[model samples]
Target chain A: MSADVLSAYPASQLAIREVGLRDGLQMTARWPSTPKKLEWVDREAAAGVRYFEVGSFLPADKVPRFADVREVIAGVSRHPGAHGIALALNQRGATDALATGVQEITLVISASEAHNAANVRRTQEQSLAEIANVVRLRDEAGSATIINAGIAMAFGCSLSGAVPEDAVLRMIDRCLEAGVDMVGVADTVGYAGPRQVASLCRRIADRLGPLPYVLHLHDTRGTGIANAAAALDAGCRILDASLAGLGGCPFAPGATGNVVIEDLVFLAETMGFSTGIDLGKLVALRDIPAGEMPGEALFGALAKAGPPRAMSWQAARP
Target chain B: MSADVLSAYPASQLAIREVGLRDGLQMTARWPSTPKKLEWVDREAAAGVRYFEVGSFLPADKVPRFADVREVIAGVSRHPGAHGIALALNQRGATDALATGVQEITLVISASEAHNAANVRRTQEQSLAEIANVVRLRDEAGSATIINAGIAMAFGCSLSGAVPEDAVLRMIDRCLEAGVDMVGVADTVGYAGPRQVASLCRRIADRLGPLPYVLHLHDTRGTGIANAAAALDAGCRILDASLAGLGGCPFAPGATGNVVIEDLVFLAETMGFSTGIDLGKLVALRDIPAGEMPGEALFGALAKAGPPRAMSWQAARP
Candidate 1:
């Protein structure tokens, strides 16, 4: 009997977009100090992760969690060379981002019609209009802030059960029409299984062709890391992660736990992927305790279980 | 780039064991109702999961959290054709298990010297002796309880840093010497990443010659589900999981979260394995609210994020 030999995925590389400072803290009640976040940026950069979604320029009242957007951006930008990213929900946020001197900007839109309305109090069409306006504003500013139109709720919406591929496709088209530099797909509610993640990501990548893509995944369903792994196999490079897996959807029922950055980094590194991360240092980072974070529970396996033999995925290879 | 092709993993005909009633509650401060545990068993069975680690059989005073083991066993066994697995730490536990008339009997041994000492307060040799006695007891009882000697801490140990693969292989020899039916591997402290899990499992499976090998995983470090999936790819069939991602290492620092049974089932299904599960029913089972049991944070995605359209993985193939 011929042994059914399965090929290991190609040696891949991933850029972790640390979103804890933005999306993660935004969903929580107790936010961290901007200095602490900036400190993490310095340290994470040292650990070798690039692309960081450092903060979001949303109305401070809407999310006091990100009250230090300007401070964070200013602090991270000082790092000689670091890809500090900020989230801009509208033209105003984009304009605010243009001043902070960040290298990248992410504009988000909800794909689920119901989630778009309930979450941002706007329709998908309106969110698209805002994205289009943000794209134009970014170009006019002549700043190098690469805008990646991040589509939230692309797989399944918290409010709606079915997220149509056609609907998600339309949003991608809108982002491209809006002249955005790149695009991102998110399983915002952590509703997507791997099959859905692969099919949709493959479809989006097929449409966009080559240009790098980002995946913002939630582990609310406990499939975050697995889905992220699947996304990598589907040709996604940039991964949006929260330190200690600190992320969730306020609207998505039971949506908690972003793909754990430390754990995902370990998975990639061990699998012979050049994640440019030090697994040992990443594990130590998750060791820090964040208290009274409420429903925002910290999630991951490699941290608690300890590394399988103080084994750095790199040490075993090189 | 040969248009990187996306190969879908068939809806995994995966078998999940919800250990919340057993593994999760056993190590924690609280254990919910016989009714609640039974309710979960019935709900999970209807959800298409065929096996469950009903509960442990330690003295009630020693593990009052699992005093209802008999009831759980009786309640779950009534489900016509379901696999009810029970954990037996000693001869007494095994006696109770034999009396309960379970389909399987699983014993534990930590591959790490320090871990084995801490867990059952015995040396590796002592544990083996106990395991051998339990195996003999099962034989005498004329019970069909398949003996599974799970060697935990196979990858690495929290206290013992690096658990050598040879040590794990030796434990398999001990289990085999005991006349046990099958032997399984576990990342007791969640120290395993995908590569470590795959490598260790492959090496162990190579030595064991396939005795219905199982993987008992914890998501403490966050790679539990991925590790389990990797084990499956490495040729392990029997896997251990807990409903709602419950369970943790009482001794290990900051290690909690099991491989969520529902999420694993979802991964298997979406990846194209026939787990013989009903996703819709599984999602609906969330209303049972396993989280109300106190201090245990239960998790599963399909229960929260509605299944993706293409998530009817089984149906998609035909």
Candidate 2:
């Protein structure tokens, strides 16, 4: 029997970054207190989450939930082996994020022109130009920050309904042309199934040969892990998740924002892949932010269920 | 590029019956009203759920949640092709279910001795003895009530921890010996991942021959859909889903009771297999029973994100 495409996704050591504290909380009705959000990052880092997208630099009024994002980034950045990341919707956001001394800056763009307009009130062409400006700004500042051009709504868009592959390809072409250090793909609304994700990611991976791309998922439709599996099969290096399936796009009606970081980590680890995150601390991390946020809905598998008994179970495997 | 084992699954008429209403809701909070319970079955059946296990015939005091189970079964039995199933925990419950004229009777047993003792305070032999008696009772009653030797916590038991394959096989042997028409497997504590689920189901399927085994999932550790996919790959037909990822086991800490029916339906349909369900209507099922059970949680995907576009942008040759 053939080993198959999915059976060969680098046998774990798969790295998943919790982008929820930044991306998820920013879009919620309630925001966690600065310290609470920091505690979330701290607990996750303690749980073995090596990568973090701490915050984005949009106007505080535009996303008040992320007002203290800067502080959250600074506090979490200090932890050893725990990398801090920030989002850049445009040149200004990129410059501000780079100024934080964070080593990684993720620039997001949309594949659909209609969605790009609806998302940031800019056209896809304008978003592409912003990517160029952000890259130049990071380069001029002498920050060798790993610039990942994240193509948001790459699978399907709520406003536009369905996004085309050529549209995603064009966005990838623009990101490559802008000299991005890396690229990322997202089913921002959780519309991707396993096969659909695999097929589209293979097309994207084929185009952007060898560059590490991030796979961001939303459990809104509960295909988050399935999509992640497909992405892994397509060779995506980094995955984005939240602590407890936090975050949703208010404009997207029913969209859940991103995959729960802890759950995805368990899936990778127990499936014979190694994610360096500590499961015990990750489960505990749910409490720190939940207490402060109050009404914020936190969703995750491992947070509610403790870590997988891989050690004991593997030992018992006859 | 050869076809994977997923091809063997019945793609056209995949009727997933949610036994959670009977099996899952039974163990939850104080029993809801008869109308409230019927509302769930009505909504789910209307949402393209062809089969629904509305309630069980266990003693009222022991499992008050299913007290008015007779009303629920009678109401849902009216829906065309909606096979109203009821769980019979013992011969007495089975006799009561037979009186209701339910087409399907699910006779459940815990695969592990520890779990069996904990669940019904009985030994495995005692449970099997009851199953054989119920099968005889069904035959004498002159009803075509098929028995499903539903094994709960088949993957891993909370008390026993890791349920052995031999234990599962022993139960299957008992089920067949007792003349069960079909067999089913449950991951009651949310412990089974797809790889493990696939490996186990293949062995179980080998013993059961062509009798379809349903994969009952709990999203406790976030491997529900992946396990469903694995089961599909292993040629299992029926799947169990709750309306909206509602109801987790209180005893199982992190277990999200069952896979969301809408999400499972969405996953199967979008993967190019026909599940004979209309995705759009499935989301509307939640509305009918909303006020009846105010605090009850429901989980689903298509309810969040709409269906995928028939057209994709991958630029593949038509």
Candidate 3:
């Protein structure tokens, strides 16, 4: 059957970016050692995961787990076609990330003022200015690293509550005007349903007109993958997911985890969009994180239920 | 916002059928006492849930939890606008269910031969014959109860693997020819993705030309609510969900639970379809199941994360 026969989106291929090392580690108290993190990257790359958010360039005191960001990037760089990404909150962070020779740097600013302040201790305008400076620094340094501005709480916010669609679009516009390579809309608190996701993402897509947007979703209220599906329906291509559904929004009380990368691959591939990631290998790597944080709860239904019997389960593995 | 503005389906009013008391209990070892089951029904009824699958009429030895099916029905009958549904495997089961004066009796027959045999110890044709017999008996007794044929494993089967669309369509046709009032498609193994659910449901709807289909989903692989959303997009109004996402398929190994009723309501209402079920009350009732089944896992994202701040949380209460 033709791919578009069932697809609501225009794209024939879907891109899934791994965020377990960066986003997952940030939420957990325990951190995988640099070697373990590199091993995780290598295993995932073997499973055909080309893109990864290796770690963040935050202060070592603020996020000690990601202090080895350079090592992580160097490890991922060994694999051909493996694009290592890092998160940068300010000009200093961006400069540090660029020095590591990372292919991409994600700059985040929450659409909800309360969430932005709570998360970054800065006003939205201040964050926007920092993003512009980071872009300029990258241009001056002649870095080829792509800048992806992640609009956090674009759907809704835990601290500030309902984020207006106009506010989110305005944020996207500001980020675009700052000369970022790409932009991502994140449901930081997992407050979005499929309709809200589809409507808002479609609106942004319409405004951007060919400029692709990524969906960074959390399953806080358990609408993560469904919202991702709706985002695809709204023309989203790149999806941010964590292995074994790791990570949680510290601001959103009772928020559990990010959308399970394994499940998201299942959803995308099963819906006729090729994700190019091996489900078996990704699901198997759940053990790596679980081993590091012994008592921590890891989640993903595919790891437990196995693949659907209708498909060639054995053939899906490497 | 008008319901149809965002809805892909034509229905403005959505029907949520609570199956926690029956389907949820079937695979569970702990049975809430008859009184507890009655209380559960009462609480849900008060929460504006109009339909419920109260019990199944299997042998007491096979399903001892539902031995007091009559008592459960009697308890639900007191609430006005409340419709009590029961499942029956054969003529004997249907006759027993009919004596209890249930508003609806669902006859289950898996679309897959292997599953049908394993589930009911009968071939597909034999089960179909029994359903016909049950329908004839209801007609002869002049019972006003609607007969719903629930085609299990309609999406895909763990036992028999990929069930062809034509096989499912033929089964639906046979059930329709058997004089059943309505038919429901069940993802017995949680093997369905949104695309398959939407495509097949749409095909069935197109062929039937207005026959309302119910979606019986399992969260085994964590696609339950997403599949529920797809079913709605395909014009399905009746959704079978368990409170606290209770229940699992005894036959399907490691299948976790049905779609969470609380999350489904959240999804439906958030998507502009008015389910008329109070989310606050239903969420509170999760405690009853959790209390009765100690150490047993109860699943739902809304119960953990609380309601989305976008909605008027206080106003959702009865």
Candidate 4:
């Protein structure tokens, strides 16, 4: 078979970014100690996972789970070729994140005005301005760190209802103008279906030719993995998912975690797109969170069912 | 907007078959009483669900839960325009099912030889021969009932693994030659990914133009809903799903239920297809099963998260 016939999306371009330590632990009942967190990063990196959202830079008093963000990033940096990403809501958080010399710092701006005001106590314009300041700080420091501005509630919002497509595009235009290295569209509350995800991803590609963007999805309504496949169909190569399907949005009622990374890898690999991560090793990593959290329900089907026996179908591709 | 712009697939062409009564109750920890089963049928029918797999015609000793299959069908038959379907594994089950005057009767034959042998204790050829015998019996009875031969493990088999596309097509061809009114391809073990679904649906369409086919998918590995979307994209309009995702296969280890009907309806309605089923009413019906079968886990996301505030996007389209 020809290379194109082997897979719709080229394997080299596809990437799965693990956000378990950061997004997965954000709303957990218990937190893994710094050592356990480092162990997760190390083991996943050894399993061929190249990108990880280690933690977020936020107030220690508010989200004490991520209080050891600096230590986590330092440990992640020790592994060569493993990129660590952290989240920042404001310039202060962004400055602190920069001080850690993290590989990537994500700044979020909700597309919905109500969500923007409620989440960060600022208007959409205000959030955009903060992102600009964060970009300036990175440039002035002569750092080569990548800045990714995520448009939260880009698909729809729990507070504001349906987010218009043009509003999300406008936010992306502003983020691009702010000199961010990349932009991401997030279904913060899992409001997006596959059609909506495909429509939005196609529009993003159309609006900004070859500029890179990521899809950060939540599985609150069971559409996350489908949306991920739609993104791949629309030529999106980077996706954000959590281990054991951890994480939820406080603002979005009944919200669940991001799409499970293990299942996401399975979906990608089985679809003939190589994710570089070993499915067996990555699925085994679920035990870490299950052991640490104890009572917390870690969700994923691949972990429960194990990999299909015929997983080598992709390997036999000529 | 033109009607074509409203939905990629015309709303009238889409159909969701409720398999909860037969598929859902099969493996439940507790089975609802006959009256409760009738209530489920009545409520979902009132909610505008037209097609239902009421129960299977099996030996009462083997599956006592379905011993009242006759009563359930009698109850469902009273609802005008509500079509009841029943399953038959052999000629005797088919004879009993035809006697009930059910609107549709489904006969299953696994594509994988091992799965067919293990599931029905017959070879694939033996099962196909029985299907032909059932069709002869239906014709001789001069019944208007539709015979649907479901190719179980059509995508892949847990017992044998990786059922090839040609194998499924061969089974489908034989079924057509046997004079079945309709055919279905099932992902019995949840091994199918979206790409495989799209490819297979396309081939089925190409091989037999305009032949109606249903996709009976399980959410064993979290790809059920995604596979449903791919089927729709590939022009297969019929889908089989259960309420609260309440079915599993003994042969497929760790198997969950069929894709939740509530989520499937949510996905269809949000994608601009008019299912003619009330989302709220259908979600509310989940309570009946929960109350009747206490401690049996009912799975679905739309029931937990509720519909999005801006669900009228489809209605507003041109």
In TM-score terms, which candidate is top? 4
- Which window of ten consecutive residues has the lowest lDDT sum in model 2 chain B? B1-10
Candidate 2 residue pairs in clash (backbone atoms < 3 Å): A12-A273, A12-A274, A13-A274, A47-A278, A48-A277, A48-A278, A165-B313, B244-B298, B244-B299, B245-B299
TM-score of 2: 0.87
Q: Which lDDT tens digits does candidate 1 get at residues B94-139? A: 9888888877778999987788898889999999999889878877
Sort order, lDDT high to low: 4, 3, 2, 1
Q: Who is ahead in DockQ, 1 or 3?
A: 3
Worst 10 residues of 1 chain B by lDDT: B1-10
> How many times do residue backbones clash in model 3?
0
RMSD of each: 8.4, 5.8, 5.7, 5.2
Per-residue alpha-carbon lDDT of candidate 2 for residues B120-170, written as tens digits (9 for 90 to 100): 899988988998888888788777777888898788777767777777778
lDDT scores in order: 0.72, 0.72, 0.81, 0.83
Summarize candidate 3's per-residue lDDT along A1-318 as a digit string, tens digits: 011111222255577889999988786879788889989999999998888988889888977898899999999899987888899988899999988878888999998888889889999889989988888888888877888899998877766677778888888999888888778899887778887888888888889786677889998877887888888767788788999878976766445678989888888876767677878888888878988887666776777787775564212211
Q: Mind giving the per-residue lDDT tens digits that candidate 4 earns over B185-276?
A: 99888888999999899998898675667799988888888888888888888899999888875655555679999889888876767889
Score chain A of model 1 by TM-score against the reference chain A: 0.88
Best by DockQ: 4
Output the worst ten-in-a-row residue range by lDDT, candidate 1 chain A: A1-10
Measured over the true interface residues after superposition, the C-alpha RMSD of each candidate is: 4.9, 3.7, 6.3, 3.1
lDDT of 3 by residue, B20-130 (tens): 989888767697888788899899999999888988898988678988988989888999877888998788899998888788899998898988888889998898888
Runs in model 4 deviating more than 4 A are: A1-11, A252-254, A313-318, B1-11, B313-318
lDDT of 2 by residue, A1-318 (tens): 111112212334476888777777766666677877777777777767777877888888977776776897788768876777788777777778888877677777887677778878998778778887877887788875677788988877766767767767777888888877767778876667777777777887888665556788787777887677657756776788887777775555646667877778777765657676677877777776678677777776666667545434523432
DockQ, all candidates in order: 0.32, 0.39, 0.36, 0.44
